[model samples]
Target: MDIRQLARGTVPWDRLERVATILARRYDRDAVRVEFLAADNWLSIPCIVDDEWFVKIVTKQHTRVHALLTAGRNAGALSSGSGGFFTRFETPLAMVEHEYEATQRMREIGCNAPEPIEAFEANGLGVLVLEYLPAFESVDDLDATRVRALAPELFATLATMHDNGLAHGDLRAENLLVADGDLYFIDATKVLPDRQAAARAYDLACALAILEPRVGVRSAVAAASEQYAAEDLLDARDFLDFVRLRPDHRFDSTRLRSELEKWAALSEG
Candidate 1:
């Protein structure tokens, strides 16, 4: 079946059947139903087969992004989280492809990230199918200890990626997804190339600064931060800045930024 031809405007039920049949023939798997899912940065169509797997046919732009991102390079910053369409940028395909690739690379390095199944594009639609995670709820549910636990793991993963020459420029809470009771970094459009030491330090510091306000020094957060710092993956100033930036439980960005600047001065001094 011509995936491209079948992927025209709105796929009618008959066409969907033909597409499923083609997929079964090509991938050697039986499919049950095809339904539309969320379209955050890329258009997503979830195809449910047997109990074992589901095929998410993403648009072509997203597919390209997954491929590029896995190579460890800067695609761009992603505005979306695990939810729905968040940001708009050119080269949707390239960004999505790189994002998927970066996440896969992170998992391979023993970092916490979603498991990628397959990514491809046919008929202007790019797609990536990944092992689904069930436990993660939302960013708001996380507390200080959780953040602390997550920070080190995340930093370690980022360090590994940097060692291999990959960078995720946009490091925020929303971009992280909890799956199977573990944290996994999801979006990768902002991944950079070459792993500049100073840049990594700056990025990590900024993230810490941002997280400081939210998680604070709850014993868990403090312990996690100390462990991560021991890796020499983060600079003292950055870590301090992170501590300073921890947000008030009320979720105030302005106040957080104000606090970050104060720490920034201390770091500069």
Candidate 2:
């Protein structure tokens, strides 16, 4: 199936909710929220079960298409210039299984990650339900002051996770949440198995990039650096060279890189 073609428009609510019956068995039908997420290449939908839990469905088609697209980036799915599109479809049951396992692994290793409540197939679609963190707030909602205040704890969470040999590959600001004075990491699909320092730093850098615009590069870096040893900490500078080259990040790279270079020089002095 051509996931790109199929995802062109909003999918029919009824067509997508063939799995609602499964949800109704666990949650009130009236309270359930079926949201078809946008901007993703996959059929990503979540059934918000009245703020109690979330039933996340990642279709087999998306899982396969996503893999093909990744391979296409190098092999060229259709044509070298096409930047091509390769799609695949699989049994829905297999789609959510990997994520479910990953989440459990993170939780097992003591990271504040979500745990699976259930994993099953519904009407040929793969679904994994999880414990919803209703009180958590996205990093996007945080201001410079809030970010600075919590920077230490945030850094500690990443550092500790890194020290333990697990990496949260998707540490986007939104994926990091604060609730009740602690941090919670979500979206565990990309958790890496090795304890490579570079991978850990990459996660820290991802969060810092998102925070840079909000807290200013120096303040953001300062707050985060305070918690970890600068000797071998996850240096945002390393990732900056490549990350800032992207269009969205270019505008701030010069200023951020300058501040970082100054910081490095001053620390050395």
Candidate 3:
């Protein structure tokens, strides 16, 4: 069995049924159809209800995994010469509640995100519901040319988030989805309120890492420059090595650092 499967753990059939029944009662439906997603997610068991709501069922094990990941991320932040900015939740409900609030905040600040429905606990499990996107593709599924075209917009969105004091503590290709030719952000993690600046730089680094392999370091840096200053790009540079350490991201950090330095020099000249 895959390690991710073991880490994600499992939700017993009876408990899951109780969750579904609660959802049905809350939505005033006689019954609801639940489709479990085969997502490679470590923190939640995702599903669709009645093809209308996206649901995340969080277990105690999920909360424990999140705590571990938060610690690891904080350690990475420390390596970047900054104090840890990532926040950890003590319970399953807190995890979903944070995501729900984060998503709502993103949409409130003119960022594109799915409509958040509600977050609640049922049968000792945390359940978050949001409007489901029936037709969409993750950024990872797009071709290079398509990604190149969307690169600037991606940076622009990140800029909007940062300008409003928001940070997507986690940024990866899979967390970005494109529906109807519009970009949508999802699965934002919690960050400490006072450490947003560091989180911003980290977010920028992750974005650069995501685009580097598909669009090349130069193009990635170029696109980022459209929304971030040369200094900001350099600040993001500090987190490149840290971002590379994540299992989800793979890029030529040395080349990215070189390109960022070149871009800064050209901007100063």
Compare the candidates by lDDT and give the number of the best one: 3
Query: Where does candidate 2 stray beyond 4 Å?
Result: 1-15, 24-43, 68-95, 191-195, 231-235, 245-251, 262-269
Top-TM-score candidate index = 3
Expressed as tens digits, the lDDT of each residue in 163-259 for candidate 1 is 7666565556666777666767765544233334544554554455545566662332343344344333324243333323334223333444444
Ranked candidates (lDDT, high to low): 3, 2, 1
Better of 1 and 2 by TM-score: 2
* Clash pairs detected, candidate 3: none
In order, what lDDT does every prediction score? 0.50, 0.61, 0.94
As a whole number from 0 to 100, the lDDT of residue 227 in candidate 2 is 59
lDDT of 2: 0.61
Candidate 3 runs further than 4 Å off: none
Instruction: Report model 3's TM-score to 2 decimal places.
Output: 0.98
Candidate 1, number of clashes = 34
lDDT per residue as tens, model 3, 83-140: 9999888988998999999999999999999999999999789999999999999999
